[model samples]
Target: MKNYLSSSQMTLRMFAADLLVLSSILSAAWCLSVLNVSVPKTLNSTSGSCLLIPCLFNISKEKQNILDSSPEVTWRRGSLWSLYDTDGFTIAHRQKEPVMEVVGDLRKKNCTSVMRNLTSLHSDRYYFRIQAENSGVTGTTAVHINVSESVAEPNVTVPVLREGEEVNLTCTVPAPCPSHPPNVTWAPALGGDVTQRTHLNADGTQSVSAILNFVPSVHHHELKVNCVSIHPLHREDRPLLSHKVVILNVEYPPKETWISLTGLVWLGDNVTLTCQSKANPPAVHRWFMKRAGVEEELSISHVLSFTAAHENTGEYICEAQNLCGAMNSTNLQITVLGISFTAFLSILAALSLIFALLAIAIVMIYRRYKEPIRSETNQDQNIYANMSASAVKSEQLQSKPCEDKNTCTINPVYAFKHDLPDENIYANC
Candidate 1:
């Protein structure tokens, strides 16, 4: 009978112990439910970097008055099941030394926390806990953290572009997170020509892509095409995270060609003329000269260098061409400071030839006229001498009027006059 009585008393004491423990648990639950914490369920960040978590706490206004003017906030890295888990370390605390470092103000009811030096191994949930001093109230919230490796530059695929042909530049990058992906933007943005899309990856990630489409021209040659990613967890200076840039390999002919020559060139001076143009397939150049409205091809190269002289002076032109067509530069008039010695000698030789021809013509005419004038004067003098002799003979014949008729010849003057057939000559005799 005494053993039965002792067992009954022990049973009662055990029941009371159970009741007291249940009462204490219920009171704690009630207090915790009143102090509520709100925060996002999931957040993403990059590995080897920092993460900022937004948090807020709410409690009855009555409790606010009762609590200490200065409340305390703490952050620890653990799951909800490990509320009192001492294995978890405190990363941040209000008015106390932080685990690493925090960069926000909590006095103004900002419960935001910053996690630093995070890695893929840090892929765990964190909890925020707040203490209202003397009010015997506290709130807690959970934050699921996803830390991924830093982004890599996008893969680029671009084909060589032919003139007037359409082409595309494609770039792809692995998404930073499955829930939160980075945005893609093209460098030197092409309006209405950019295309973007995304694909789901097997490892709970996404692959984002962008493409630029256009018809290539010579103007597009050597231009850089870039695909840039803007990351959510990037720093201020490094807002853009990953990128890929490639030079456009477009092919076309020469354009806007031109030649350049020194102004006011002088004779015997070293001269250089350059042929310049914009082209994709690199234009082959040649130099030319235009004189007397005629073209003279000079060189088949980009530059023309020579010593200046009168012969070299003219309208100089540079012709640049590729597979497409020919392009000519504006004419540049090259003038010399003075005439060269060779030019002076050439002029003197021409003048000497003309003078020699004129002198030969004058000598030929003088020789032809000198003989005729001299012959005519000799004939006139002989005629005058003959006439004088004839007159003297006629006087003698008249004085010897003849008796010897048989042997007499007619007066020679009379006989000559009979044959003369001129009345005036007969009277003179």
Candidate 2:
């Protein structure tokens, strides 16, 4: 902390010693300049603006303390010899009541003066003089003031361009200072070629212009073109840039059109069909119906709404048209079953009537039953089944011993249904 304080004090002491030395030198120079005069060779500013001319004069060190008394200064437009030799003199500065102001404090040996509303007529060699209480000093050197017009930003013109259309863009800059005319450039590097020329405006001002011609496409939409000005003034800093924007409005027809329905449209229900499309300039829609090989325009609106019925079943076409172009959608088949709640109730009532008649007929047939026809063979079989069980016995045979081994004598009884009832039995004859 002690070292820091010591270093701070040393820095302040050194600054004070340097300031004292500079004041002594200035004081000596002020006294010496009284014998001579000093002025700049040239100074420049724009016309209708202010000019700062650099000058220096000196007073005695004793008189320099009372500089607030306001030293008097004069600016003469002609040479010293001519002004003294000629009777008439053009005075540019009188200091108190004139527009020209002396910004320098005369006691400090600074005699810089400002000239306001500079014009071409004021571009002449001038002399500065300082008048004290009893002594006067005149400048030996002449200061030449050159007044010219200021550099201005270029005007960029971009026309209303459309796709595939030929267009031109122009950039204009006023060249009042023709020797230092500003160059104009466009950003995004447009067109066939950049053409430059100097032309005269109606107000008699000369202007330098650059033109760019091109055939604008859809890709150039909503883009900005800049007109830059490269001037010698503050060239190392940044160039002046101005821009004009052109937005293209492209025209195209409707495409990819389709229809949208509210719901599953049935008979006697209010249904809506909306036609839509994508287009630059929006197209108006109309619904067309082709029924029974006959075509007719149905509605001239974007939405077609009606009560659905069997008669409304047809090929529905959505047509879109605009000033640019027209388009038609593919055929859409719309069919209503035409079966409503009333018709469904009527069908149920008819079915119930048919079922009731069939039931009555069935009940009458059951009450009046009739016997079926039978064959005689079945009757015989049924009678035999009712006979005694002994009537179904098989016949027996008796064999006697024979002399030869291969031959035998036999006796058989051929009686059939012997125990059966006479009405059912039959004898083999």
Candidate 3:
């Protein structure tokens, strides 16, 4: 019995501990649910621009026991406390009664409201109050409204256009305007009014446009257009954003011209030439060959099939013209190979004839000098013959010196001729 009681006591103690943990968890969950039932705390806006302030709250339970239509939603700005009112603070569907003239929608069960057409004076802390039977359970949300004085500016875009093409001008504002709609005006670049259109947003903001529909002219290209946005609250003619310019560029004519080599052809053969021009309406190309004393216009293909000669070796002009302007090409040279070859042969023949004459002149001069050389050779032979005879006579006289002893003496007349005693030759004679 004692062991049984001890076991029972231990079981009871464990049950009590588990119950305590469950109670703590339930308390924490309840605190979290209460904390999650509050509204968002801040809101912001720009000056001179329209804004929407949202008032919303969160509820913890899904029970439908709470009436969806009885919660009251109220909004206050600065020291003023009565701007917006609704039936239910946590209900999703409730009718709204707004004290301000601004247009907005209110949701009751969700406990949220949107205020539009905000101005700079609306910059303040806004408080929301809800009336319910469970007064302490009702939630309040505080919002800080930030309003600036900078107004919305319009955007403009320009595109490259062509003649007779329709041009569109669009102007877009950055944000919606709650207080007043902006007026857009269009004036021609030169100074004239065109058709205009306007579009409105549900928030009371507006966008306007102007269009000029006419065949684009050079005059229009040089002119400018204006996009003006006038604030309704401001003075008439005084646009908050004014005088945006739009310039139009139109494509009309091709601005380039060119020509290319067709191919090579033999002498007396036919060849083709081509001329090209770039223009909007396409250009007309004319080919002219400056032959001897004539400038004949060739056909569109400009294929001159005549036998090419030296006379045809002049400038061939390709003229391209369009409605806008005309351009001419440099003269192309056409050469005839037959004429070139003939001229080369003539030069070689003249050189051969000159060389033959030079050879004949050299042969005649050699023949004319040959006879005088032969005569000089004969004279030299005679002088050698006389010297030999004198030498023979002197030898004979020297041998016979015994017969004529006195003759052996040297002779003064011939002493210079031989290195011998002068008495010998003289005595022999």
Candidate 4:
């Protein structure tokens, strides 16, 4: 009888252990069931734009075993007001009639709905409920849809250009909605469609540029070009942002032409010339000279010295240019002369000495060859003197008594002749 009691006690202990294990398993399953359900609290969306309200949920382990078929998902606002009533919100099972349409694939358990053409009236709290078999659960999410009255204005940037250069205007509309993209158009302030080309960006926001390649005239100065953007909601036809006026002031250097003193320039000469041309930006004056064989630009002051020679001559050209245009002066020919005074004086002094020597030689030759002639009366007087002396001696001996008388009569008579005749041959022989 004691042996029988021991076997019964062992069986009772095993039964008690089995009951405790079942209780613990049931307690764990109950805790998991409560954690499976969740509800969203907030919704985010931009003002004056579309909103996508997501109804996201996951089945818990406890709820997974309860349903073999898809659960019925229903969308509502506030309390029981239904937004979408269908079977699990699936595309195939969804009721054809719904308050709002669902975009993208809805079968993959993605309960996301898009509210397009949203207005201020659609702003409110929304609720999503799931019903399966005999169990029903509800989750709540708040959607704040702000419908703004005005849209953002676009930005425009114009390229810098000189007058007469082609103008390419670009308009950029940023962060635009795909459903209602901004429309871009261009118009000139001067009237007429001067735009030549256009371009668009991939995003609903666009980049539109108009190329005006025409040569700008003075009439277009200070002209304003409008890059207008129109939205589906905008009532005005004008542009959202008016770009600043671009005044193309294409300036070129001043053009000038003058008589250039180029080529071989003799010393002591000035190179004078004139320059002519037209430009937006006036050109500058720069005079340069290059020697016949040299390749460098000679300095203005240094080019032709006050003593310029033939070697100083060379080809010359003037360059005039600015941002708009360029021009050059015509080539000029230059001539230079050389002069010295010292060389002339030396030649005159030599000729004067030669003339003096010739005059003296002629005078000496004439004096040495000529002879003087005397008169015939001078020779006859000499012979008469000798005869008178001999007669006087004889008379002295014969006549002592008449000495006194004769001496008185013959008292030494002397004769003088002042004139000589060149006709007589014996004048001075």
What RMSD value applies to candidate 2? 19.9
Task: Put down candidate 1 lDDT per residue, 59-93, tens digits, no spaces.
Answer: 66666553356555556555343334343244332
Per-residue lDDT value at 197 in model 4 = 33
- By lDDT, rank the candidates, best first: 1, 2, 3, 4
By TM-score, the candidates rank as 2, 1, 3, 4
Residue pairs clashing in model 1 are none
Q: What is the lDDT of candidate 1?
A: 0.69
User: What is the lDDT of every predicted structure here?
Assistant: 0.69, 0.65, 0.54, 0.48
Q: Which 10 successive residues of model 2 have the least lDDT summed? A: 89-98
- Of 3 and 4, the candidate ahead on TM-score is 3
Task: Give stretches of model 1 more than 4 Å off.
Answer: 1-119, 122-148, 161-165, 175-182, 199-206, 215-226, 230-241, 245-252, 263-269, 280-282, 292-294, 323-326, 335-429
Instruction: Name the lDDT value of residue 299 in candidate 2.
Output: 82
lDDT of 2 by residue, 86-131 (tens): 3334333322122467877665677767777556567777777665
- Model 2 TM-score is 0.39
| Candidate 3 C-alpha lDDT tens digits along 248-275 | 5554544445556655544555555667
RMSD of 3: 17.8
Off by over 4 Å in 2: 1-162, 169-198, 208-235, 340-429
